[model samples]
Target: MKETDLAVGNTTVGLSRTLVWLMAIISGLVVANNYYNQPLLALIADELHVSESAAGKISVLTQIGYALGLLLIVPLGDKLLRKRLILIDLVLVIAALLWMTFARELWMLYVASLLIGATSVIPQLFVPIAAQLSNDQEKSTNIGLVMAGLLLGILLSRFFGGIVGDWWGWRSMFGIAAGIMVFVWFIIYKMLPEIHPNFKGSYKQLMLSVIELARTQPVLQLASFRGAMAFGSMSAVFTTLVFHMEQPPFQVGASVVGSFGLAGAVGALAAAKVGKLQTAIGTYRTILYSLLVLIGSWGFTYFAGETYWGLIIGIILLDLGVQGSHIINQTDYFTLKTDAVNRLNTVYMVSYFIGGSMGTWLASIAWQYAQWEGVCAVGATFGLLGLVAHLLLSRKIRLAAIKT
Candidate 1:
């Protein structure tokens, strides 16, 4: 329950199941702010008198903001009081939500989204806290549990956003989000244990450390690149899904688009449960399996996009692939740096953010040219790229394993 107790020299502090779940829940709610605008983009656009194309900037800007935060803020966790930092970030997020609720112009929404993205760094804080609290042996498993909640939040935030927007209005969704944030903030304060800093490195040293990590760790480099590519594929699929569903062929409602969260749920759950597979089979093998699913899912679009069941199956497969690959990547990366979790996270998350941005940008362009087919092509292309990366690295990775 106390930070000092966890400092018992590499031994776990014996966290209760209830405590862990409570922390994960709070972390999930705080992180959900980043995606709240995504499902409601159409509604936000209409209210602000912009086209859907124009409203796409919301997702773009928020992602940029998140990337900036990952670079600027997450590194502080290694040197700061994580509980206090998380609390402060939560307050900032609440203010950003309030700004979103009151925004009268599209530009105002964009600015608020930037702040929301920056403050939604709470999830990053929880990752380090989770690592610090766990024993050496349970590190991956604990991280996986927290990641399951985090990914579920990332997936379901859109569902909550769209449902609230549909039932009330777009602005009301932010107001409701603010209320939820306020409540979650209270829970977080009561539940999360304080984490004493283990490394109080200077900013320059931290930045340099991340660079050194990039250079020294072959697995980190490959995993980060593969992660970015895989996420880019997913982003391409997600960014274009609304457009495809809203237009002529499907004409689906926002609620239906939001229901993709169910597929995400399946995927997150699968990742959390497959820790043994990742540990035994290795990151590359799991990534290979996930990539195959991604390829199959994209190919399924040829037959499934028009049919209800087919669409559902495609989404399920897509979510499973993306989430599974993500788990493997994170589990592998975290193992590389025992003492510098923040730096490791900073590098990995930056890749993730970059990938998401590229995917979104490409999806927009692809939609303009080849529509949904183009998006699927992009997804499959990334999967193939990942396959190649894995194959090229296989010999080296196996050699490194034998040496270890």
Candidate 2:
């Protein structure tokens, strides 16, 4: 075999069932680092003598850091040994988590949160690695499985953080996260076989290509927009949920609010199955149905303040819609340019998080002005906007194909 073929084949051969599971687990653990502070913001403010608004910036900064990492570090996956990059990032995550555990000042926490967010791009790296190892026929299936793990991590992090922070303090939560990272690092070092770089270019050239790919790829543009809208809407709901629950009808504590994540986890678990459906229905139809589900979620969530059951049902539908559409979007995007999977992912994710940040900001404003009704309206509007964008873009693409 040629050197490149040997490298690819060796990487594939190394991806045993157990190894895939390990990757999934590690991805979940790594990504969870970005979210551990969400449910602990109040606790953090009280303990650190910071304002609630200041404590909230920990989550915001973490997301900004994650976007930065997607732009700067994830693309390097295409140009370097992914195993080494993943391992190095895990070490950085552990160190950041440790710093977070011991942080006394708000500034110390903010800096650590940013570093943790930046290094937490390991899951993003692993998804493309999974794609590279699997053949085309199985690529979506494998990626779906890995992404399910990622979704679970995102949903469960709040639950874990809230419970642990409540029981043993917020610092203990970070200490536990650091311990998990150390274990994950060892597993990755031992189990993940090195995949050689596909792109042999300078760092500047690698960064430039990410811009070129975004500029040139229409499918990527549409997919990124769709993902951004879906995730942004989802973020709006989650970001404001704690405040909603603490109000009159519910009056729940952080731990109880955190348990809501379990409902969302049910939806994330279905992502692998959603991947199978994409083969039968195609991405466009799949996304259409997913958006419909998302709209339905907001409908139920609109009544969440009055009925707890509505929130439970809404959480399930919201997560299912988001995770299903996300899997399809990724599977489709990865097909556009195999060699640029990492960079393509970076573009898609950066847009996705930016949308999330906007959604969170918008939702906060909505809550302040009109409360739950406004938040639900905003969430549903995002879903509708995504559907409309997809319809228009698909029609344009079809017309262009016909003319050509």
Q: How many steric overlaps does candidate 2 have?
A: 0
Residue-level lDDT for 224 in candidate 2: 95
lDDT (Cα, tens digit) per residue for candidate 2, span 233-324: 89888877877787888887678777888999998997668977888988789988998898889988986546889999999999999989
Off by over 4 Å in 1: 1-14, 401-404
Query: Residue 333 of candidate 1: its Cα lDDT?
Result: 71
Task: Quote each prediction's TM-score.
Answer: 0.92, 0.94
Instruction: State the lDDT at 352 in candidate 2.
Output: 87
How many angstroms is residue 384 displaced in model 1 relative to the true structure, after the best TM-score fit? 2.1
TM-score of 1: 0.92
